[model samples]
Structure formats: C-alpha cells, structure tokens
Target: MSSVKKVLEIQRETIPYLYEFKDSKLTPFSSSIEEYKGQKQAYVVYSFNKPETEQGSGSRLLYTRIYPNESAVRTTGDFNTELGEKKENFTLNEIKWSVYEINGTPNIHLKGEKDGIVYEIVTQEVSLREVKELLATFISN
Candidate 1:
C-alpha cells in the first residue's frame, strides 16, 4: 500500500485515463494531488533500476500527471526548448502523443484527453517502445 496506490484508488473514478505500471521492477517513488489556480491535479513518479550487468544500469524515472478536467490542462506550450527535438506525432487509443529526444537520450512525453480528463506522461531514460508496452497494459475502465 503506497501513496501512489492510495491516490489512484481515490481518484479511480475521477481520472478516466489514469495509468500505473504493472511491472514489479518499477516502483512508485511519490504521488500527490496539488492545486493549480484552484484546480486540482495529480501526479505520480516511478523509479526503476537496471542490474549493473545491463547496458543501462542506473536509476530511471517515469512521471504520470492527471488533469481532472479541461480547465486544469495546460493549453499553451511550455516553451521548453530544453526538451530537444520533436521526433513525431501520433495518436493511440484517442491519446495524442508527441515523442521527443532530449539531449540524444531516450525519453517520451505523452498527453491527451479522454472522457474530459487530460492525462500526461513523461519518461526519463525510457524508450518509446517501452512506454508503448506500458501503455498497452492500461485498462480504460
């Protein structure tokens, strides 16, 4: 029973597109509900580490964010040139996602709206293939 699970349970009905990793190797680091201009948003961070023998043996972080309603979602660009290059754009299961390569490192940023709730996901040192695999596990409930 972690804070992430608790938040997910409480927000299960509120967030139509909420997702969590099913892999045991990935564990939630922290989760919380915060307010932005009177609107509440929830976010969870998960951390994973590969074995030292593996090529990418180090700590990696993945982030998930839920905007409970249309107003809470950021409508404008973040103006983050630091995100590096935008590789491509595609839609998956109604979620429009943008793939970006940050400093030649593997990463992803996915944001979309479903059932009026806006959902976003960001990954650090995580490959696009891996992110898609995780998304495939999500049950729309």
Candidate 2:
C-alpha cells in the first residue's frame, strides 16, 4: 500500500484529524503508525526533490507526526516549560504552536496540539515562513 493510503487508513481508524501537504510539489513517499511506551504515533513523510530510496534521506523531506492523545505528545507544552521561554510560539484557531531550535544542530522542531491530539512538522531545509504555511495548512484541515 502507498504511504498516503496507509495514512488515510490510520486516520479513519484512530486519529480524528491529521495534517497533509496539499502542494503539488510535495510528494508523500513513506508513512507509518508506531508505538513506544504504550503511546501511538502516526507519521507521514513527504519528499520534495526525489522519490524511492534504499535508505531514506532527511534532506528536503517534510515530516509530520500525529499523536493519539495529549499525554502521548511529550513536547506539548515544552515551549512554556522545558524550553525555558526561549522559543517562538504562535496560535491559530485555538491551536497553540511552538518552534524551537535543536541545540547544537541546524534542525528546528515545530509542534502543536489540538482537540487532545498533537501534531508536529519537522524539516531541515524549509524556512520558518514555509513551516508556518505548512502549519496553517494543517490547521485548515
């Protein structure tokens, strides 16, 4: 089964809401639902530059993760607490979001929660504005 179909199946069975890229330029190539410490997480990976690989590469990839519940999402309120107020926070339609840099790394993490489920979008190449646009797209969904 294709990644998109897998995501749809997972969404239909468990998640109430999920985010996806609607742009023609982004192509979803991989997806899966994982469990760790009894928590469920659904994720889809979209690639912008190429397709199909023996080993996946993170460059130019857009990754989105969906957690089944608030407690399942560890970074839910990290910006206000663990992050020590050094992150960028924003909101849209009652959904609160935060973008924080991974110390000593070039990657940025953007996370948010809605209706008890948490959603996250992470990439190494996309700009903050582009990330926000992606977040807005997710919110609209």
Candidate 3:
C-alpha cells in the first residue's frame, strides 16, 4: 500500500477538514487537496488507474463536503461526453462527479447536502510548483 501523508487540517464551523497527499503508482502525478471559502468544503484531484484501458491511466477530480453530526451525500459522474473531441486518448469511466467550464477552464464540482446545510468543493489542476509551495506552507503552519 502507498503511504499517505497528512498535509493540512482545519475546521470550518463545527466540521473539521483534513487534507492528505499520496503518489500515484501508474503515473508520475500526485493529487492535491484544497479548501473553499465555506467550511466543510474541499476537493481532491488525483490520477487513478484505469484498468479498462491498455495504458491504465485516468484522472479523478473529486469534491467532497462534510456535515456536522450528519451524513453527507455525494454525486459523481463522467464528463468525457461533454469533453467532445478531447476525449480520444482517455477512457472516462466510473465517473461519479460533475464538471463545469468557467472562463475556458474545466472544473470538477462536488457537493454534499444534508439537513438543509450544503457544502461545496471544486477541483483544480495541480502543478508541481504549487504543490511544493502548499506543502511548505502546510509544514510551516
């Protein structure tokens, strides 16, 4: 099993949020976690193994929301159809999330709702420099 690293932990309102990072065995990529303005909102972007394809490579942008003393609902789906011609090289499967395009950039949107309280998280593209900076800040904090 791959070792997991706890990068950051913070509380938003009553719910506590945690961020973890791990390396992908199938690719040279790593996933990063980020939080939004509201408490209980965060997202994780990672490259996952796609056993259905010969290359065994795929990407997953997951958004999650945590509720206070309640269970959260999660929705996920594939966006390859919406990706149009860009869907050639990759086989999008087991998609249980949604994607939205804003200002020409595609973002994965994940939401959790329970007892009338909702938490929203968005997934963004990860970069090596950004990850280094984030880890440095996390370590310093």
Clashing pairs in 1: none
Off by over 4 Å in 1: 49-58, 68-81, 103-105
lDDT values of the candidates? 0.65, 0.64, 0.33
| Every model's TM-score | 0.67, 0.68, 0.26
Q: What is the C-alpha RMSD of each candidate to the true structure, in Å?
A: 4.8, 5.0, 13.3
State the lDDT at 68 in candidate 2.
57
C-alpha root-mean-square deviation, candidate 1 = 4.8
- TM-score between model 2 and native: 0.68
What's the number of clashes in each of the models? 0, 0, 5
Over the stretch 1-141, how does candidate 2's per-residue lDDT look in tens digits? Answer: 865776667755765466566676566767777666766777777776554563555467667777755444444332222222336888965667888775655556777777777777666576677666655555434
Rank all candidate structures by their lDDT, best first, as comma-separated numbers: 1, 2, 3
Highest TM-score model number: 2
Greater lDDT among 2 and 3 belongs to: 2
lDDT of 1 by residue, 22-122 (tens): 67667667777666776667677766665656543246767777775545444423212256677777767666667766664556666656667667777
User: Which residue segments of model 2 deviate by more than 4 Å?
Assistant: 1-4, 35-40, 49-58, 70-85, 139-141
